[model samples]
Target: MLTTTTSKINIQVRRFTIFDIENLYTYLTHLSPETKKRFGPHKFDKQSIFDFYRESDKNIGYITLDNENHSIIGYFIIKRGFLAHDRERLEGYRLTLDNQTDCTFAPSLADHWQGSGVGKLVFQFILSDLKKMKFSRIILWGGVQSDNTRAVNYYINLGFKTLGQFSHNGNNLDMIYSIDQSTGKTDGGFDQ
Candidate 1:
């Protein structure tokens, strides 16, 4: 469990539970349209999320308020030793370690809690947890629309470098960012 003192937010990062499915679904539904279009089309219904909790619950991680509020702010799926099939793009980017240790998908705080540094705090918590898990490397990928300069700049400022850019489904061009474990830094350059 990692807590950020600066925000007065106590975050406990732990395995998912059957009880968390509904909250996860609610949170996903409340995501901004732009955020949904970028990282989503999630395949989780109540039953599916519950089943996933039973199956890979050991590896899946979630961060929630430590108080009675029990609010789920963010969640991430981490694989201790290999990238799942869904993480193939991350693998193609050559960002995984021989021991794997990669974060498949991580979504920030729900819309209401965004822009309050909750996302950065959660990310830092994940990084600290990864180090304790003996992971030598960690990486995440995000697709940014050319027009969304804010999203691109956010990733760059967070230490991600553009690996390349490609068009998907015809007109949507997406840029890939990669961070090396050794340096934990990015080049901060755009391909175009």
Candidate 2:
């Protein structure tokens, strides 16, 4: 578990549990249309969310909550392996995919907390955890919309590299991040 404070409120991040279903559902249900459009790896409906948890044996969900009210402020999914679509797209770009060392990452923050620095804190903890788990790289799940400047900049600021681009509803860019296990730091020029 990771804990920190932002805007004077204590926040905690940990793996999702059965107890978090309702709270998580509330959070997902309340996401704005823009957010939903940017993050559509899975359905946000109650049943779809529940089905994802039940059927996703290789995916892990992490939730960030506020200590004051225990409301979910962020949610992230770390997939153990790439999906067929992602693999195909990556292969077309000549980028190698290693199931043992590469995983898919997707993170979303509450609309209210979008630019409050909460996302960076949660991401740092995840980077460290992934390194410790022996993962050497991470790919952005479903890639990111080329026009989502904020997200594109955020990923670049976090050491992700643009491996290639593809069209998905609109133009999308596939990004990859290499984890330097030796120093527990991300290896890439995006941050430089």
Candidate 3:
């Protein structure tokens, strides 16, 4: 299991292992609609999610934030150094280099935790782990429906910049964002 320091709230961030895949599956399957649209169609059942750990080239890490009751209040996944081709929305922005690394996030929490600073804590943990993994840069592409102002603002606040807008379905266009880890800046005003 991976362990991370928590804030004064006493939330602990720990890495998920093969044994924890089932729990992770449960978490992912029940995420909010906004999160599902951004990172879903996970394309795997419980066994497949577990099998991924056996692959030598993949780096999968999950951090679960537990509350005083020992119940998981939040979680995040980080896949190191690979271009995710399954996400059709990112077709134009896909990384060309084999060495490029990208990150995606899915947070599962009740509405109460939305702006309680839980995301910042989880993100900071992911960033620290990425640095230790020796990745020079990381990109996170989030799709926001034009009307989803809350999500667009959330990603921007987290330091992701909008590269441009692209249509996902015939009716909704997604705002693409990119972040440069080297400078910790985004193309849009998200970094500020």
lDDT for each residue of candidate 2 in 4-109, tens digit (9 for 90 to 100): 6545647888888767888988999899999988887678777887888788777888898888898999999998878777777899888788888889999999
Best by TM-score: 2
| Error of model 2, residue 4, in angstroms | 0.8
The parts of candidate 1 lying over 4 Å away from their true place are 8-15, 57-59, 66-68, 80-99, 141-151, 169-192
- Kindly report which residue pairs in candidate 1 clash with one another: none
For candidate 1, give the lDDT of residue 17: 65
| All candidates: TM-score | 0.66, 0.91, 0.67
* Global CA lDDT computed for model 1: 0.53
User: Candidate 2: what lDDT?
Assistant: 0.83
Q: Lowest-lDDT window of 10 residues in candidate 2?
A: 183-192
lDDT of 3 by residue, 6-111 (tens): 3445466667677776667766666677655655423447866766666634555555555565555565555554345525445555534334445544444434
User: How should the candidates be ordered by lDDT, best one leading?
Assistant: 2, 3, 1
Q: Tens-digit lDDT track for model 1 on 49-95?
A: 66655666345556556454676766656544444443555445565
Winning model by lDDT:
2
| Backbone Cα, N, C clashes tallied per candidate | 0, 0, 1
